[model samples]
Target: MATIAPIEYFDEADFDPFVIDDDVFGEIEDPYAIFDRARANGPVQPGTILELLGAPADSIVAGIPQFRVIGHAEVQAVMRNAALFSNDVLKMNLGVTFGDTISAMNPPKHTQVRGLFQSTFMPKQVAKWSETLVDPVVNDLIGRFIGDGRAELVEQFAKRYPFEIIYRQLGLPQRDVQTFHRLAVTLTFNSDYIRYGKEASRKLGVYFQNLLEERRRNPADDLVSLLGQLGGDNGLSDETIVSFFRGLINAAGDTTYRATGCMLMALLENPEQLEAVRQDRSLVPLVLEETLRWNGPIIFTQRMVMQDTELGGVRMPAGAIVNVSMAAANNDPAVHENPRKFDLFRGTKSHFGFGLGPHMCLGQHLARLEMSRALNAILDRLPGLRFDPDMPKPTVKGGLMRTPRDIHVLFDPS
Candidate 1:
């Protein structure tokens, strides 16, 4: 008889969506140390940081000469000069799963498509949603657990918060939150869980297909309705609209989920900073910015070499896949003083956490709103909020999507 391991016997129930395979890459306790060493040698390194940490490269990028750009300027150079290093390479990777979303497009085409949603995510537009959308979503989530003195926030709040907001914003029923979130998370793990990922993709595609039809017949005040309305005469195709919304879920969902957890964990670790923010709510914005700089969820993003290029005096041949380490660039000593420490007052505001150049994150304002509102709601409601004394101290895991396994915390219930 053929033998199968015990680990392979589990079902979908075993999938802890919050953890999301944080240790699948063999958890690196200090990825910065590796980046520091690589930076000391040169601004650009030969192999990807994940590979250096013992995880093998994805088959798609396996044979490519991978370069890890660590310095702030070098990272900006690559991000800014999208013409030389095209983001279209993701078309072959993420495109296979996400279709031809704008993130995977380059130059003129990218600029054109982004304009469609640019106004929606602008700071002023995003501000309108703060009261109507963001605050209500935050309070609704807090109300669920306000009576409990202790909660594993990663599972109860951080992980669930962003997905709920995203679902509601899309004009989907509140009941579908879990289903959509699971599908989104599974689809993102296409490389690891191919079977589930493909199934998730199929289900999501079919659901959107029907929803698009419904929105066309009877328009509503929802993102899907808005996207549906946009297409018809001189707008977008139904397929492009679906891909755009799919990309939004993939971009705005997991990243915010992980980032929220990271932000909360950072504050818990630094009690004095947490107290300072609690006392003066004005520091909320600074805390959010500092968190993004100190420990952003996304560690790196990939770009393919469009032509022969040299960054930081290192010549990169055409067809090379460059992994720009935003996390490393944020910690570069050249730009930030005492790069390792997390300070709310650091105030230098420039970091590659949200990326740079044309393909920078469009939903950044929305993300900031979600994080800020969530923090404010917590501080206002959860008095004496701190790490649970009996449980294991939470340490952030993973090299890529850095998030704590579970943000276990204790607080005085309202």
Candidate 2:
């Protein structure tokens, strides 16, 4: 039998911040190192950095118990049981002073606030946005650079699409739009640029506060305008709206940008699969799924335990900071057959891409629609498209959100 070291500590919150150190954060699942150590190690790890950051039990990061990252089922548990695992994550990352939208609201408040956004992001609304918002923008941008025959996907396509779409939806002025885009990106995943993130948040907070005032006086036709005009018991307040804008901007910008890039690259590499879909065109949705499965944009989510529980056979105490290892979970053999292989034709229903249950990505449907449209635009217009096999392969960004930093595709405008 293999000798297992007696675990020195399981409750990460008990440890002093200066003493706690976790190596798991180092093992990011990039394209070069997909699920190397993390998947093999299973879901629960006692010494993760996330748990280590929390204050002692008596002085947690917030007044609430600290949650640690864990495995697929544990992730499923938090996602599934909304009551226990609150989606109000703003409390954890962006303190209440910053903002609190539906994503940060609990139960009754969350449900009501979520509905307001839902009404704006419904299937019909998304479709309308595609027809009215996305297509025109993509066509205009590509038309400008179509003759060039090559462009950096991130700066040109992935970033621009969501930035424009979300900016318009949120009703920010054009002058302020780019700043917000840059700010959103920095706060979400640009960990290297802490000062930029802090400045961006500070500016956006002030900007949104002013915009909220404007909307109150004379609302526009956009979603934010509508949200501002709403009144009653279930309606959101200005502070809550500001929080939503902050979270939504970050969530919208990072996820869609990553999704758009990830899907396009996957389609390029998996040529046979790409060709298979391009031949029929009806398989676009399936292609998106395969792309998400092949290279999920968002890697992990965290949940705090309310009581003593067992996850993946490991007992965890209350206040454990559990990361729903989405990247590892997606590749978990128990869920998807031959997960590493990207078979667009594969028959798989559920995936950890947008996660599952109540907290499942609010912007998923819209993201899918935008990504599908962007890809179709390329496939339809640009023939003879394929990866620049000669160029170095793109690397995936880890932490908070996962995505490729570079996805270079070479093709003739045939």
Highest TM-score, which number? 1
Best by lDDT: 1
For model 2, residues 1-414, the per-residue Cα lDDT tens digits are: 012111122133242211111121222444223343444555555654333332122122434434344355666776787666665454554443345656556777777777776776678878888887888777766676577667677767786887788887766656555546656765542223334445556667777767767676777677667767654455667777777677778777777887777787777777887888778888988888877776787666666666687766677776665556666666766667787777888855667788888767787888888888888888787777776777777766544455666677666753
Each candidate's root-mean-square deviation in Å? 5.6, 10.9
Task: Report the lDDT tens digits of candidate 1 across residue range 44-67.
Answer: 878886776666557766777888
TM-score of each: 0.93, 0.83
Candidate 1's C-alpha lDDT?
Answer: 0.79
> Which residue pairs in candidate 1 have backbone atoms (N, alpha carbon, C) closer than 3 angstroms, thus clashing?
none
- In angstroms, give how far residue 188 of model 2 lies from its true place: 2.3
Off by over 4 Å in 1: 1-20, 23-26
TM-score for model 1?
Answer: 0.93
Worst 10 residues of 2 by lDDT: 1-10
Residue 299: error of model 1 in Å?
0.9
